[model samples]
Target: MNQNIFENISDLITSGAFLEAEQAAVDLLEEIESKDDGSQAFVIFKFNVAGFLVDIGHALSNRGYALKAVEIFESLEPRIEGVIDPHQYFYNRANAKCHIVEQVSTFDLTFSSIETLVEAKNEYWKSIKEARKVNEEFPEQYVNLANCLKRQFRLSEALWYYDSIREMAPEIPQSWINRSEALLMLNTVSNSYSGKMLHEISSGYNQASRSKFLPPDYAAYYGEQAERFRQGISENDHAETKKEFEELSEYRKYCCRSSLTLSEHGLYCSCAGAARDNLTIPLAATTVGGAFVPQMEAVLNRLKSEFSMARRCYFEYTEAEIEIDLIHEECFTDLETNECLGLDFEKLRTAFRLCFGVLDKIGFAICEHHSLKPKSGMVYFQNFWQLDRDNRREKFEEIKTPGLLALYSIATDLNEHKNGEWKNFKRLRNAMEHGFLVIVHPGSVDDIFGAYELSGDVELVELDVFEKMVEQMIQLTRSAIFSFVFHFRQKGLEESVPTGPTVSFQRVNLQM
Candidate 1:
């Protein structure tokens, strides 16, 4: 008999007889963990086994054991996620938890899942953290941050950020709608103030919005809110503001404290007497942090049926990490046909903005072309290069923000060309940065076109599906650009190294 259990279990872990393989593997892990029995390499190997256990848990497809797998991964993530490329693996762990959440949603689970946008909040923080370090997730991070803030009811600050993006990427239509939302909010808040305050804030914003493009109903809506704001403040009553602040504070406290959410967030804790009630069952004898929940098994099964998904995502991320341009050359989704783009500071702030100038005009002439001028209140994002910047240096960043805003203003002024409306890559910039872009001129074409089309018909609530599509496009575009830019970088031509573009883009214009 082989004394080395890991070696023997490795041999036994085939597609045949998964239960027996699982038990043997568990026994080996137990034995090895007891002594300082392996080198650092061996410890790394154990993590791989643990990740595999996660994979196996999915293969079993038993809901009763779902919580068990969640416990195992949650524990391993702190330890193992760091052992390798932590970002790649932690993202996987997050996805796994999300999968559990999605599955639980399908069933009448013990913990009632609320409509609170907690996962989106967590994701927003993670993306923002990434953006701060690399400046890679600018547009997407900005948009998501704006959305999360809106959800948390920070209307004023959210409006400021969205306004900056419209100046930066004016061609994107969603920014317009987003701006309108915030303006409308301010319009309501203005009712509490004197007419002078309303006149002051609404000066530039109101004039820019009066082009007859907005539907009559929406225009009137903005008017009503503005008028309401003027009435409330002169009387000096702040009941609305105080109540809103109080509610928002509670939301923040709930989101910030992990302890408050962990129990409900976890996959229905067995310690809560779920097993004895027969509310849960044992689908497989999986060791999950000293307890078992049947859904652990079910969650695992779901993951296995879709196991190639993790590799697929990593593969995509690898490709996208290459360049800022060529984003449209990538895949739209694992399944969709639309092309998406990614932008860096230089191209987005420079070349990309050049494209939006023409698109903005096209956007205004709704009858002339395809346009999705971003609604002002939506979101705008840009990433900074290094997260390691100290507080003093960070304060410098705060100071630089005004300069950034000024620079954007200059760019908007430069766009006063009254030629035929030309839609360049501005929409692509927003799509790359914000995940939503103007697909078609909402007023002109019946369908909206974008780097990725978000037709009103389809919904993208799950990050796995959305991320996979985005990452795949990012990867495909990156790979294509890297090979081309290996020796040279140009827009339409790549001659030396040969490969097809990951995605395709078309430059269209309509006379203003």
Candidate 2:
């Protein structure tokens, strides 16, 4: 087959000749698959077909047929799995999916549309990892990834990516523009109302307007918005303005105090009085038909208890010195030499396990209280927000609670991503549970001896890396707990007044 035929197919798709392009693509695919020629020319033909498929996908996407573009892109995977590099292929599909969210719709609560967007986000991550493997910066992919996070209402996570893009490629206008949008959304949602924060948002728009490719009207619109933000505050007392903003930001407060207690927002308080400052729940002692209060308290308190135990183990590990006895040294030594590679510290191990363990506990509590019923008897943190275990977006349509979106973001943190650290934490947890996990000092291991014996049964992590992972696990668990509590507060704020008679309750404490 002539390569001109592939070009013709692309031309057809580009010209909006959909019916003709479909027949041409179908005929070419059949002709290519039917051929079994033992020649290099045949392999080249397959590559051409794969490229044409990608072109068609892009053409469809450019024309606003994003879902169709997704199907077209997916069809290329099996055709050239081992022959062609898939980084660009993954990127194009991600762009198409993103277009669906931008131009089409997330369908709001519809699971399929939500799945498309989430898959697009994950695909962008995969593309980023693949680009890094080849030493490519792929800054646009980073922006796209951040855009996905922003769409999911994950402004903080999105800001990191946008900020990184600005650092690495300052000329990219989208980075500044999107970063400003994210910051503005954060300030608005949290009601920080700080003049300094608004000024930063204003500055970002002005900076982005410097790009030559930016439309004059678009720049003008943003310029007006920026001026509006700037006019909100006087150009004096900068320190006080920034201070007031930081103090009013609920997001910043939760983040700064995450390590202090899991109940920084007080949703997990054991008593109504303790929760009054942050949340309000009726108490059993003063309200009629308040048995449900104690039951809910038991559930929340159990989660608090689990998190506190993990925090204590972490604290002990940080404070205590390693006492290496002769037997312990022998068990950890790679050879007869005195150098020890493996760390068999029980406190660190306990903290690692407990941190990961509490995620499932928090998941169960969220599902039970938020009325997100699971399809299966088994529930895990990663699967808490979805109806199906394999599909992360299966329950997006079902999430009515405002703060649960944030909690769902926590679940995504635990999910496996290409070149992601969270996956390593999860694998280490699995190794501890079902196999062998060794925390080794990288310096103690000899290069001459090779990295390790060829055994699939054990997982080896450097001591520094393991310690970092333990710390991350603790923080992750804490964030999930905070999100869980905030879910109720957000719900309480959203719900309308009760139509039925309601009881008033007072705080009571028992003397032990």
Candidate 3:
């Protein structure tokens, strides 16, 4: 508890030297334990020493050293509980446990990690409860508690905390963000209920509080109520109405007690309002780059920028897909039709144009990254083969570059498909650009459907076959991006793009 030593350890923690701070705190604790006389002055010093240990433990946890931090916090728990402010003690302890959970989640999870996660959830609850007892308006604790519930997949409970914060402090964006996330998760579960029911259900309360044991016929009875609520909310704008209906349907499916039997009692009741707690405070404004090594930071920034552009392109492609689907839904009876007579050929042509546009952007992205130039047309088959041959001839004759090889392989395999869809994709794209009137067809004619002009057929390409080709191209575009990132990292131009959770894109359903 020497003043100079205490300040030095604090400085180390502030400077992100967590290991040094931990070691200094440990040495200080040992010195305090080895004191010859247990005098009043020494006892006072012991309290300050314990505070240092807690601070060091917290610092370690903040820097991703969760396991080590948990050990320090656990060891000092009994001594630090009543000696220091109980709120601070519980808060730091909870944070250390939360960090442990975060670290465990980053790995391939195992049975052992489940127990650790449960412990972390319990600690977060304890910390929130303690903070509430001391100061009910402590918002940071509520944010942490809500976030913990979210990580636990207790979305209903998490939404309760988020909503509570929103009600208390409507101006805070994080609470709204968290609540929207919960709502989106719930909406994914169901999308057919009414707005009022959505409000009632998302409130995390049992509408029929006294009716715990719903009869077997409850679904039929509640179905009527849900229908009435849906009609009531339908007066709102279309988008808002749809959103509320979806959320309400989801709530009824998973949350409404009337939809449950006696045995299922208390199963979804954990999110009820009476059991809910929350607080509010101004949001903390901070960024997290200074913690990373300078080399890693530069690499991460560049990759992030590149991936962001790729992501935007992907998003545009997805939007085009949705638009095409909508057009098809409006115009055609069977979505899988090879030909739909009387369908607006103009709309079909425009849809195909959008789909082909995505391919061009994806191709350009790859060529630009590899420093290759295509004089004309999309860099699909011909350009890829040329680049592959040039790279092998100039760079390494024996071993092909992995990234280039991957790109060439994908392009070659797609082009040589047994169904000849890729060939039709190229033919149709070229025909469209050259002033031929594109026509939709269900099946191939003479291996490819021909584009027409006022006088004669100008080019031949099949639309039905091209459907499968488009799907493959989407996947290939994704793989091409992955290969480029891999090549960049392998070249040591930048350290490996920091690992994160695998990005999963949901399949878009074109059929209604």
Best by lDDT: 2
Among these predictions, the greatest TM-score belongs to: 2
Error of 1 at 287 (Å): 55
The Cα local distance difference test for each model comes to 0.34, 0.58, 0.44
The runs of at least 3 residues in candidate 2 whose Cα sits more than 4 Å from the true structure, single-residue gaps closed, are 1-63, 78-85, 102-110, 187-189, 234-355, 371-377, 385-399, 409-425, 441-457, 462-486, 498-512
Give residue 369's lDDT in candidate 2 (0 to 100).
59
Let me know the TM-score candidate 1 reaches against the reference structure: 0.25
TM-scores, all models, native as reference: 0.25, 0.61, 0.30
Q: After superposition, how far is residue 173 of candidate 1 from its true place, in Å?
A: 40
Candidate 1: lDDT of 173? 36
Off by over 4 Å in 3: 1-64, 103-110, 132-137, 170-512
Q: How many residue pairs clash in each candidate?
A: 76, 0, 7
Candidate 1 lDDT, tens digit per residue, 82-200? 35554434333433343343332111221123122234334444544444455454553455445444433334335545655656765443354455554444333222233333432
Tens-place lDDT per residue, model 3, 150-219, is: 5543444455566567566554434544554444443332232334335434332222211323322442
Residues 87-131 of candidate 2: C-alpha lDDT, one tens digit per residue: 676777777777665443211324444545567776786787677
Say which prediction, candidate 1 or candidate 3, comes out ahead on lDDT: 3
Q: Better model by lDDT, 2 or 3?
A: 2
lDDT winner between candidates 1 and 2:
2
The count of residue-pair clashes in candidate 3 stands at: 7
Between 2 and 3, whose TM-score is larger? 2
lDDT of 2: 0.58
